[model samples]
Target: MTLSPSETARYRRHLTLPELGPAGQERLKCARVLVVGSGGLGSPASLYLAAAGIGTLGIVDGDRVEPSNLHRQVLFETVDIGRLKAEAARERLLAINPEITVVAHAFTLRASNARELIERYDIVLDGTDRLSTRYLVNDACVLLRKPLITAAIHRFEGQAMSYVPGRGPCYRCLFPQAVEAVGESCADAGVLGVLPGVLGLIQATEAIKLATGIGEPLIGRLLTYDALSLRFAELPVSRRRECPVCAEHPRITALEDTAEACAADAPLSVRRLSATALRRLLVEARRSGPGLVLIDVREPWEFDAGHLEGARNIPLGELRGRLDDLAGEGPPIFVCRSGRRSLTACAIALQAGMAAPAHLEGGLLEWVAAIDPRLRLVAG
Candidate 1:
């Protein structure tokens, strides 16, 4: 991982630093990073990562540049509008640093190829706009145990976070469900244009920190920026014990084709109900059943085995369609095996404009332990 003469001169500024001297420069030369999407956020992120001398930089984008993209996507010029984004970004990044190897993955990241694509790299920088693709990258990284630096933009504001395998929370731990275009798209909402540049820079910084093993990465904290107010905020996050993909008994053990991401990304919002309190609510609801509904979001067999008395079955996958059934039925309470799927259900309900939706905290396992152990239900 020794640096050549050209690399030495190229990264002269980095080499002069105390912490990131020759050793850090060499680590950057040895690092392999995949930058997913070369659009708004990916644009500045890829540029800096290349400028910083990431040894093998890969760009994954399946989009064609357009005239509108020129204003924000710094990787493309007017002449490159018709070109593929991955190829275009590869050329731009390489032109910036020919000393580094650039790999172009000119295809969409899908369930079929996510693992293989992500497995090839030491770290992943996800600056994708599509919510589904974002989740796909997150799950694949968590499964592969690779470090992922992810960011998102909405209007004049942006956010960034990092996920290091077996160390901190995954994106799903922060946002456990894929919400549809509930007012999330930049095309529809309009972006400040320069907003993503800030977040993308943050993504690049985190990747370099992770690669060079230097500055503390945003592993368990979410970094947010507000353009109008010029404020940067950090929110501490913790891994959910019932997280669908990273938990003890993950309900979503496999990757499936998520629907086309027409929805915009939303903030994390879910209410939790303790087992002891829910039992009282169930008793109260039995007399006046219209104000509240208990939803069991699990497999039919799991529900049939044992669930809270008076709970209705509506598995998490089908929770979207069943949302309408509960219309005017009052704000519902969702339950699942280990509280994972139920949290997803709560998020879905909130996205659908329903009243505040809540999940049984810790799921039925908590109910069994805290209230009724004789219920004969086991944690899956």
Candidate 2:
């Protein structure tokens, strides 16, 4: 394909590099890379790849842009909120470089369609937020024999690695066990605005380097970055002989739905207590001067209703950020309408290294049914 005058000018910087001369540039132009998740990491990685003239770019994201995303998702603005991320990304990328092709899939990457969708691209980039999606993306990439450049971000830290087919180590090799339930994600933890940008840029460099066959990639090395300490470390990763996915006696012949499995594998933070147990605790709280601190992890409106007499209100979304504000604890018990939000609260409190934080057996619903049936719980 012949480059137009504008494309020639746009990629002049890339043309100046010895490894990425006209031939390498052409290879990039001919590359087909599928990027999963058009969030933080995906935004920068896809933008750079498109600007670099990656011939065919496929962006898959099932989310819409939000006002909060503007801080780190550099591709979008306040005006782009409520728009499909993939569609918005495609428009911005094409406007930046009309020479390249950008395909957008504004749908979730689920088990039913992952395999077929992955097979269409030469390389895969995992920019997803959850563990389930990461496993799904990894498995799909391996099955399709596509190179995957994966990265994940947390509060002040993030990690990145590259997985090539029949190469050193895959994601499963490192994280063999199902990950433990996380207390808070980026949404709850409050990530540094520039952290994902730096990590995403690294991801983009890795993808471009892999596509152009330039530098030695991080195939068997895991790069960990700590923004707080301003430190970077690269740890070597080795393929596990006992890995279920890529082992000598591989158990997984085909892709499996890991979403539910991952959820099951993770240990729940708050264990279910019987109604009898809560009654005993309530008696204990009545006897003690400062009874157990019953915390409602639901929204504000839910707390407006009569709670366990003197319960505190702190929504689960803001729990991690407000941990320090909490008083010296008695046996802290968390509650929501159902048990789900309390479980998340338990996880976050535990991760924050809180002392003796517990959850209402089945949250406010259980509390209402067991202690006081007349109390009405409302949603905010």
Clashes of each: 4, 0
Query: In model 2, which range of ten residues has the least summed lDDT?
Result: 260-269
Candidate 1 on 134-253: residue-level lDDT in tens?
Answer: 888888988888999998887777788999999999998978777665543558767788988999998999999999899788988877677887877565667978788989788877
Badly placed stretches (over 4 Å) of model 2 are 260-380
Best by TM-score: 1
What is the RMSD of candidate 2?
Answer: 15.6
Tens-digit lDDT track of model 2 for 1-380 = 66667877889998889988888888898899998988889888888988889999999999999999998898897899999999999999999888889999999898889998998888898888766788888877877778999887777777899999898788877664445444543355677888888888888898888888999989988786778778775555678787767787876668766643322222222343444576787788799776767778888777776566667888877998888877576646787776656755765675565644666655667767777788887753
List pairs with backbone clashes in candidate 1. Answer: 180-263, 181-263, 181-264, 184-264
- What TM-score against the true fold does each predicted structure earn? 0.73, 0.68
List the candidate 1 regions with Cα displacement exceeding 4 Å. Answer: 268-349, 355-380
Q: What is each predicted model's overall lDDT from 0 to 1?
A: 0.83, 0.77
